[model samples]
Each structure stands twice: as structure tokens, then as C-alpha cells.
Target: MSTARVWAPRPATVAVQIDGVRHPMTPGEGGWWEGPDLPPGARYGFLLDDDPTPRPDPRGRRLPDGVHGLSQAALPRLAPLDWPGRELRDGVIYELHVGTFTPEGTLDAAVARLGHLVDLGIDFVELLPVNAFNGTHNWGYDGVAWFAVHEAYGGPDAYAGFVAACHARGLGVIQDVVYNHLGPSGNYLPLYGPYLRDQAANTWGQEVELSHAEVRRYILDNARMWFEEYGVDGLRLDAVHALRDTSDEHILRTLSRETDDLSRRLERPLTLIAESDLNDPVMFRPRHEGGHGLTAQWSDDYHHAAHVALTGETAGYYADFEPLTALGRVATRGFFHAGTWSTFRERTHGVPLDDDVEAWRLVTCLQNHDQIGNRAAGDRLSASLSPRRQAIGAVLAVLTPSTPMLFMGEEWGASTPWQFFTSHPEPDLGRATAEGRFAEFEKMGWNRDVVPDPQDPATFQRSKLAWDELAHEPHRRLLAQYRDLIALRSREPDLRSPRLGDLSAEIDEHERHVTFVRGRIRIRLNLGDATWRPEGEEEALFATSDDVSGNPLMLPPDSALVSRTIE
Candidate 1:
């Protein structure tokens, strides 16, 4: 027996409905109601005053019968874990979506492939959100239930086992958590109290009440439960820019401090990674310096710059990005658009980098969930470019001084199109979503009829990785390149940490050639229309072209090579 409580200020009387019986709940302070001693795992709901309709718990831990159904306190049988207590700094993060990672599309199914990631040399596996959303399949940015894990992904215990499996094999687990906004359907917070503000929704049609103490506590507690109770090593706070808070202390700053304190108290390495569009250096800056001291934040400027260079795509946000110029500045300064004019935004954006900042505190990637999954066709980098060009991008990403992330199946170039897909229960929502997806890509010159419907199950099935591709020629060769490059990053002292000050770049804008130098090593590339010999004197460590063996390096178009001074 346990006390059941809920914050329901709108109703005069609140009662707990358990096992087909109604139990009265006494009113409490601050718009909260409580009932004495209730069964934990029983399917329970709240009966408010005159309204006969049952409502699910706002802070529910489990949802056995989907989002619009009754809630239960889930008891997970967790396997013992042997965590290495590895820090975020000593990790190579691999971002994976559980539903599309394997053919089974469950957490337990994903665990069977953990050995593959371990063999590929990734220490951290950052999963997409597993929070209970409206659909069976989603990108997870539209999660509504903060505590409950997705029922289709083997529920809460399966998630715990997945984490244990990762820990047993020396891999740290970091998860994406959406705190900014909840999905439209199955959202019950507004019914209980003023969870959402009076203002319009930011992007996801939900305005979170971040300024309210109770609302803020709800999010903060969720963070604690994932890291402290669930044994999660870190959390990737989804879209910090959308969390509108006008309080004296920002929620991000507070969250960072809490995680930092927890890391020390537990005597284990815990990290709080944030996803911010602000491009501010203050994200990971120390609190004493008047900034949020988060573990790290992702910067899309690097992606914007690199993507345009490789794919030659100048649509939408890539309009303002000058690939060669941006890469040159981002290499040394950490942010190319830091307080600069943008044609895409139509206004100046980003904060200038401070000299004391470390490059490793910012995450950058050539291919990620967003870059690959959000596209109109959802084509991976492997499908868009030549194998040699893909290897060149990998060289730039792994060789950089920042924390590099790999999208799953990117190494061996899996032949699956990761199109946007959803399984909305509501007929109106399903139609709207399908229409909206085509309209978005239609404006970009893609045929509306050709765009795959997001509501279709086939779109999701097509996104799964083809594991059998590992045995093929180029696929096997590409895997070798990735393995070697990852090993290079691990072995080389110059590739890791705090090397921002020592980093420099040289670019030939006319020739479409750029070279990035970190300490004694340099990564040179030729993005030109013609072949050209690389300048300067250094021993070639790794080259994309097989013909690039001797000095006076004549690399073909879309080729890159890493070089270093002789030891």
C-alpha cells in the first residue's frame, strides 16, 4: 500500500479509482490532493468531482495500457551492473534509435547488438528518447509522459537491462530527454494544473511552465530519476533553447549544478549534455563566469559548414553557410557564426568563444540523427556521396579536437533510408502529419507525390539497418577505415581535449581546399573539381585515395588525408 497524490486545483473533489472502486482523496495544500495507502501496481485513475471520465496520473511511472489508459507503478527487475564509472571525456558516443537499430525494434533486441558497438570501439551509446509518446513509433521529440518508458520498447525493466548490458561491456549510456514541450495528444498536465503557460507554443504546440516552481521541479526530478535512480551515466537535454524560463536563475544553470553535485556525491562520473541552438560559448562555461556550466552542448554550425562542403547543398539553413570559410574558423575559434550576420536567420546570432574554453566540451558531427533522419528523403551520408567522400568527412570528424559522435550504421554505410515516420492513433493527426511532411519537402522542390507518408509503417521499416551489408566489399573496407580512424583518435595524444589554442586552419577558397592543423598533425582535404598535390611537409598517416602514397600528394577530387610529423 502507498499514498496516491495528484495536483488537481480545477476540481472540487478528487478520488482514486482502483480495481473498479472509487476511493475518496482529501484535499491538500497548493492545489494538491492525496489518498491514504493504495496498491502500487494496480491500474489506477483519478475521478474528478462530477466528471465521470478517469484521468491518468501526471507523474506516472508506468503505462501498461498505452498513454490514454490507466497508470500503474511499474516494478522493474534490474540485472546487476558493473559500471566502470567512465567520464564523458573518455568516450566516443554513438547515437542510436532503438526502434530502427535492429529488426526486432526493442531495447532487449538492441542489447544483442551491443557487442557490435563494443567491437566497433564506442564507449558511450546515446539513445533517442524512450518516453511514452502518443504513437508506437516516433522520432521521440514529441514525448508526453516524462517518466514512463515506451511500452513497445520492452517497458522499464528492459530499458534497465539494456543499460546493464551496456555497463557490463564498459559502455556508458546517455539518453535524450525532451523537457521543452510535450506532444499534442495524450497530454494530461493542463487538466491537473497550470503546467503550460498562457503563451503560444514554441514549436511542438506546448508551452512548458518553466518559471513555476512545481513545474520546474517536475523536470528536475525527472533528470534525477534517470541519472541517480536508473543508473544512467548522462542525459542529453533535448532543445534547451525552447525551455522558456524568466526566473532569476536559469533552469539550465541550476540543472548543471545539480548534476555536478551528484557526480561528486555518488563518486562516479555523471554528465549533463545539452542541445542548444543558441551557439553560445556560455553553455559549458563555469557559473563564476556568469554562464551555465553544463558538461557540453552540441553546435550545428559545424554540421552546417561541413554538410554544405561535402554535399554542396545550399537549401534552407545551408544558405548562409560558406563551407570552406566556416570550417576554417570553426577549426580554431570553435564557432564560425559566433556573433556574425546570417542570411538564413536574417539577423546576427551566436556568442563569441572565450579563450579559456576547451574544444572537447562542444559536440560536432558530420552525420547525426537530425542530419540524416530529418531530411526529406532521409538519406544517409553514404547514399548521398561516394565512398571516398564519406571517408574524407570521417577524417575531419574524428580528427577534430571536439567530442565526435557517430550515427549508427554510418561506418559501413548501411543501405537504409531513415525517412520520417509515425504511428498516430488519431485519424485527424495522422492525416495532418502526412500532409505536413509532404508540404515541407514540396517547397524545397521535392515532388509532393513522391514523399513517403509519415503515418505508414513501411517508412519506419525501411529505416532499419541491414547488418548483412558488413560482409560486402566496400562495406567491409569502410568499416576498416572507421576502425583505424577510431584507433587513431584513441592512440594520438593530439586528437583529444583542450587543444583549442593549439589548433589552426589554412584554406584556399578558390581551389576549394582546406587544411586543419592540431599540434603536429594536419588533416588536408581537396574539395576542388580537379586533382591537386597537397602543400607542406609531413608524413601521411591516413589517406582516402590509394594513389596518395609518396610525397607531392596528388589527391583526386573530394579526397582528404591526415598527416603528422615523424616521431
Candidate 2:
């Protein structure tokens, strides 16, 4: 018999609307209202209390038109994943939002574009969250259904098909998952158990109750389902620091152990990458060593320093990173704010990492979703800097000591912006979002009207990747340069080494020039407007801006020159 359930803990009365007929639901002990014998593809919604409004099912798997409509259940075919190939550290990763990667904006369409990523020499395609969220278009951070893939993105089976296709093409797939908090809308976990807590808060809102036993199990099961059931090679846990847990055996540690067991059972290597603001090495340390045992974490220290130095604009969080010395520190130490005083936080942040830790333990990128989209108008480095400068940023991002991640269309330098967008069905939610967004920037002295409405359909349309731009001259040249740099990185032993001290940067901050040396190869960058000479004899291996073939090593403004030292 089919059953319908609604989660309304605080509400005294709850009713279900099925096929235009209203039926009173029996409220269970755990704030769950259930009705048996409901048919498949049932058209249902919840009526909370005496209110005339019918709310959409919080755990609804499929919303065809929008929220407050029929809930469609899709049973997707599950497949076994074989992952006995190259390690993540040995390859390049290209991060893409499935909705904006192509014109079709579905998993099947993304599968068709797998050849492009393969041809670009990318080892892994890290997709943004594909789980169902509110409305049609979103950033995917507000996903509610952790198990079911978005129906708009071709449902769960389509995701499985995409993974199978990626595996067939020898491309590893990493799914970005959010376990810290649920979306503002369509959140039902609270009614089931203590999945959310009122005590602890994160940047977004209330934190998920990782300290609770059942809640921990629910999250762990979700992670395993993705790796085992969905055939994803790795998981990128979003905002791990926001996960509030005071358990002696932390949920993260438990997740790592469970993933390890799954990997052993499947006889394949599975990885867990955390998006952590906490620069604690414990995230990468082994569980046996009294640590969380995550495989890797995104290192914002490297990105912040690199971005601030390159752009010379220090507003908001960038204010703490005005000096280029911070970039040099992260390059050589793996943490710029390693127990040092942070002007932004007014606190000493991050413990210093050991010099011998592998660079793959940290992922570094100059431009990612948060870096570009969180801006005033989602302006990318390509929008602010010249093509030559953009190429230089790419070179530094890839050639650095840490494992590099490239955003969608970054290699080709697409001009499109990846702005924050959402399409909430509730009018109150839409109005709240608009007011909240304006107020958020107003506190920072930014014009409130300048903040784009997240509910606008145009916002999502603007974020899509521009594929035709790839064929252009400057964009193609930059793409080729990125290809060659990654190729060299894969072949070069020194570049792959994780030894932090082995990496050194020689910079003239006043002159806007810097040189990065790894073993015998030297990467000379001239951010100055005039030409400059290197310290020693150097041959141009790669030039991002001007052609230095016949001309002597006189650097130009915002130019990059790579060379190998004479033995």
C-alpha cells in the first residue's frame, strides 16, 4: 500500500490534498502525519493548521511544475562503480555547475559534454550539488532532498547514467554534497528527529545536529549512498566547519571510517574532500592519529593571498591579505594565517601544517564559486584583469604547491558571470530573500539596489557557460597554456612533490614582479607596467602575454614568463 507522510512538528492540525480531495492525516508520535493506500504519482500537498494555504511536501522527490504540486517518485537504476585508476593528486580537476555547463542544463546533456572535458585533459569533473532544491534554478547549496537527484536535472537515473558515462570515458566524478545545513524551504528532517539544533548556529543558519546519534547516522548513510549507490568516486563535503558536533568521536571521523569500509568492500579508492575554512591539519590526519582523517580540504589561504596580491583590491575579507608576503607564506608554509593574527577576525587563526605534508592534501584555486559569485556582481578575474593577467593567475593557480581546481570556463576565460540565484515558489520567501540580500550588503556599505534579486529568472540565465567563447584567440591561447601547464605538472617530479619548503617565491612587491622556483624550473611574473630582467640566465618556456621568442627577457605589465634554470 502506498503511504503519504508530512512533517509538521509545531502544527496541531495537518491535512493532505490528494487528487483535489482533502483528507485529515493521523499525526504520529514523531510529528509525522501518515495516510496509507496513496497511489503512485500522487498529486498531494500539505495543509498546515487552519490556514487555507497548502504547503508542498518537504521531502518531495519530484516537483514537476514547481513547489506546491504533484510529487513524482522515480526509482533509478543503481550500478557498481569501479575506481581503480589514477589518484586524485595525479590529475587535473574541472569544477562545473550542471545547470550552467551547457544549454540543455541536464545530466544527460552534461554526459554529452564529457568528451570536451576529456579532450581538455581533465582527470575529474566535480559537479556542484545536483540534489533537489526549491524551484527550477538555484546554486544547489540549498538542497533539501539529499537522496534524490533534482527532477529538473533528469532525476536520479540520469545522474547514475552520467556517472557511468564518465567512468566509461576514464573520467572520475566527484559530487559536491551539503551536510552542514538544509535549505530554508522544503526542509523536513527536523520533524523526524533532532537533525537540526536551535543551540548551535552557522553562517547560514541553525547547524545540523551531528552530535545526535540518529542525525549522524542519517548523514553518514547519505554519504555512503552517493559513493556506493550513485557510483561517484569522491565527495566534496560543503562547509564542513559549519557542521556542529561536540561528540568525542566526531561525525566527520565516523564518516571517514565508514567511507574507508565502503572503499574496501567495493575494492576501489574513494576520497572525501572537505570545504573547510578551518585550516586544521587534523582534517587530513589519520583517524588512528587522533584526527578527522579526511583526504583533502579546500585551502582558502592560498586563494585569498593569490587573489588579493594579483588584483590589489582589499575589501571585506581581502583586507587581511594586502601584503604579497601572505601569498609567499602560503606557497611555502601551506597556511598564511598559521596561528598568526588575522586583521579580519581579530583572532589568531589556523595551526601551521607540517612542511612534509603532500600538496594534494589541500586544493587551491584563484577563482571558484564563492570567490567570483559572492562579489558585487559575480565579476570573474577575466572581467577585471586583461587576458594576459588572467592567464598569469591560471599559471600560478595550477603550478603552485597545492592541488589545483579550475572553475567552469576558467581555462577559456569565458566572460559570463556565476551569480547567486534562486527561484523560491513562496512569495514570502522571495520577498524575504530580496530584503535580506539588500540588508546584507547595506551593512557592508554596498548599495542595496545593486544586489541582483536571487528570485529573478534572468539571474540563472546569465550564469550559464558560453561555449562559443572558447573558439576565440585569447581564450583558446589561455586554454592551450593551461593544458600545457597541467601537462608539465603531471610529468615533472618536482612540481608534484608536496614538500612546502621545496617551494620558494622571489618577489619584488614594489615592482609588482614575482618569481616562483620549483627545483630547476622558474616561473617569472611581471605585474608591473614596464619590462624587467630576471636574476639569472633564463629561456622562455611559456609566455602568457607578449611573445618573448626572439626578444630578450624584458617582462611586460601583467605578463608571465616560465623558464628552466641552466644546470
Candidate 3:
């Protein structure tokens, strides 16, 4: 018999409603209530004591209707994943939002574009959140139903197909999941039990009740669902620092251990990458060594330093990273702010990464969703910088020791802005979101007038990548440069070497020039107006501009060249 169970101890009595029929549930141990089992395709909800309203299952796998509507039981599980799993090694990741990656904004439509990613030589296709939320369209951070795939994105089957499609194309899929906090709307967990801490709140909203055993299990189960059912290669844990746990054994440690166990049983690499603001190397350290044992973590310091060096915009958190030396330090040491004073936070921040740690454990990017979408105008570097300057950023991103990631359309230098957009059905929530967006950038001296209203449909449309732009002049040229750089990265052994100690950078602040030495290969970039010649006897492997040729080597302004020693 299929047993329908829910952990809702707060209600003295509970009932399971199926297709308009209410069946009484018997209370069980561990604050659980059980009733008759639900068959496939059954639309069900849990009815608490005295309240006529029915609440969707906290672990519901399907939500055909919106978040507020009844939960529909999912179809029978699909056949076992037929292919051998892949690993995250010296490879590139391409991050894209499913809603804006294509015009159709569905998983099937995204499948059609897998060939482009394969052509670009990306190893993993990292997707933004696809979970169910209240509205029609969003950035996917406002996801309320963690278990259900957003219906607008073609639901569970579509999600499964997308992962399988990526695998068929020799690409691993990394699904970004948020476990720190729930969204602002359609959250009904509190009505069933103490699923959320009352007084505790993070920047997003009420924090998950990590201290509660059942609540912790709820999260672990959700993670397992993605691995076992959806067959994703890895998970990108969003804002993991926000998950505050005072327990002796942290949830992350528990997750790491369990995931490792599953990895062994499945005989495949199950990667867990965290996006943490903590800048702590412990996240990727081995658990036996008193660390969390994640596969990798996003190194925002690299992005900040690279952005500042390329753009010379030192507003907000970019203040400390204004110097070109910042880029050199980050490229060599893996973290620029390791135990350094932060003028923005008004305090010293970050512990230095151990020299033994591999550089590939830290993912570096020139542009990503947060760095672009958080801006007041949602402008990309392509929107402002010359194509040659943008090419230097690409050289830094791909040729560095660390694992690299590229945002959608960044390779082609698409001019479309990836603005902050949402479709909150509640009018008050929509207004609050728009006002909050303005307030966030105001401190950075950004013009609030140019910031598009997040509630506007036009904002979301504006963010879609114009695939046609790939055929144009600067766009086509930039795309070719990216392809060559990525191909060169894969072809060269030294580029994939992860030893942080072996990496070195030379920066001339006055000349606006930087040279990165990876083993015997040297990458020279000229960000200044005047052409600069660096003494070197090497063969040019690739150059962003034809002007990068000479006896010694003359790199044009805002141009870059990759060369190797003749030895």
C-alpha cells in the first residue's frame, strides 16, 4: 500500500484530501500523520485541524497548478539513467538561466541549443534555479516549492530530459539549489509545523529550522531527489553562508558525507559546489581534515578584481580591488582578500587558502548572473567596453589556473542586458521588490532612473540573449576569440595545472600591463592606450589582435597574446 505521510505535529488532527474526498489520518511517531496511499495522477492536499484549507505536501514532487493550488502526484519514475556519469575536472562551466537562455524558455527549447555549448567546449551546463514559484516568470530565486520544477519550464519530465540531453552531448549538468531560505510568497510550511525558525532571518527571508531533525531531513531528502531522480551531475549550493546551524555536526558536513556515500554506490562523481561569501577554504577541504568536503566554491574575489582591472569602476565592493595588483594577487593566491582589511565592510575579512589547495577548486568568472543582474542598469561589459578590452577579460578568465565559467551570451558579447526581473502576482510584493532594488544600488552612486522596474515584462524580455547577434561584426569576432581561448586552454597541459604555488603574475600598474606565467607559457595583456613590448623569446600560440606580432612582441592597447617559451 502506498502510504501518504506528513510531518505536521502542530495539528492535533489531520486528514488527506484526494480528488474532493477527505480521509482521516492516523497520528504516528515523530510528529508524523499517515493516511491512505495516493495513486499516480492523484491530486491531493493535507487538511489540518479546524482549518478547511488544504496544504500541499511539503515533499510534493509535482505542482501542476501554481504554488497556491493543489499538488498533483507525479507519474511513475522514469527508467534508470542509461549513461555513465561524468566528473568535474579541468573544464569550463557555462551558466545560463533557463527562462532567458532561449526564446521559448522551456527545457525542450534549451535542448536545441546544446550543440552551441558543445561547440564552445564547455564541460558543464550550469542552470539557474528551476523550482516552482508563485508567478509566471522570475529569476528563479523566489522559488517556494523546492521539490517541484516550475510548470512554466515544462515541469519534471522536461527537467529530466534536459539533464539527459546534456549528458548525450557529453556535457554535465550542475543544478543551482537554494537551501538558505524560502521565498517571500506562498510559503505555508509554518502552518503545518515549526519548519522555519521564528526570530531567525537572513537577507532573503526566514531561515530554515536547521536545529530540527525532521526539517534537516527534509533538506537532505530534497538533495537526494535531485541526484537520484533528476540525474544531475552536480549541485551549486546558493549562498551557503546564510545557512546558520549551531548544531554540533553542521548540515553541510552531513550532506557531504551522505553525498560521498551515494557517489561510491553509484560509482560516479557527485559534485557539490557552494557559492559562499565566507571566502573560507574549509568549504572544499576534506571532511577527514575537519572540513566540509565540497568539490569547489565560487571565488568572487577573482571576478571583482578582474572586473575592476578591466573596467576601472571602483564603486561599492570594487573599492579595494581598483589596483591592477589586486588581479595579480587573486590570480596567483586564489583569494585577494585573504586576511586583508576591507574598506567596504569596515573590517578585515577572509582567511588565506592553504598553498596546497588546488586552484581548480575555486571557480572564477568574468561575468555571472549576480554580478550582471544586480547592477542598477543590468549592463554587461559588452554594453560599455571595446571588443579588444573585453577580449583581455576572456584571456584572464580562461587561461588562469582556476576552473573557469562563462555567463550566457558572454562569449559572443551579446548587447542584451540581463536585468533583475520578476513576476510577483501580489501587487505589494512587486512594489517592495522594485523599491528594494533601487535602494541596494543607490549607495554605489548608480543612477536609479536607468534601473528598470523589476515588475515590468519588458525587463524580462530585454534579458533574453539575441542569438542573431552571433552573426554580426564585433559579436562574431568576440565569439571566435572565446572559442580559440577555450580551445587553447584544453589543448595546453599547463593551463589545466591546478598548483597555486606554481602560478605567477607580473603587473605594471603604470603601464596598465599584466603578464601571467603558467608553467612555460606566458599570457601578456596590454590594457593601456599605448602599445607595450615585453622582452620574451616565445612562439605566439594565439593573439586577440593581428597587431600582436613583432621581434620582441608588441601587444596593442586593450589586446592580449598567448605564447610559449621556445625551450
Top model number, TM-score: 3
Instruction: Report how far off residue 24 is in candidate 2 (Å).
Output: 14
What is the per-residue lDDT of model 2 for residues 198-231, given as tens digits with 9 covering 90 to 100?
8777877788877766567778878888887778
Q: lDDT of each prediction vs. the true structure?
A: 0.83, 0.80, 0.89
lDDT score, residue 293, model 1?
A: 88
Tens-digit per-residue lDDT, 1-567, candidate 1 = 557888888788899888678899999898889985656678888988787878888878788888888888544332333464778784689999999999999999999999988888898999999999888898887788888888999888788888888888888899999998889789888878888877668877768988888888888888888876678898999889998889999999988888888778777888888899898877888899898989899988888888888888888888877557878887778887788987888899898887667888888888898888788889888887888888888887676678888889988877798878999999999999999889988888899777889898999999999999999977888888888888888888877886577778899999998888777877788889888776555687888768664266567887887878656
Winner by lDDT = 3
How does residue 127 of candidate 1 score in lDDT? 95
Comparison by TM-score, 2 against 3, better one: 3
Q: Candidate 2 local accuracy as lDDT?
A: 0.80
> Using TM-score as the measure, what is the rank order of every candidate, best first?
3, 1, 2
Worst 10 residues of 1 by lDDT: 75-84
Candidate 3: the clashing residue pairs are none
Per-residue CA lDDT of candidate 3, range 375-469, in tens?
88889999888888888888987887898999999999989999999999999999999999888777667778888999999999999999999
- Candidate 3 ranges with C-alpha deviation above 4 Å: 75-79
Candidate 1 stretches greater than 4 Å from native: 75-84, 535-537, 550-554
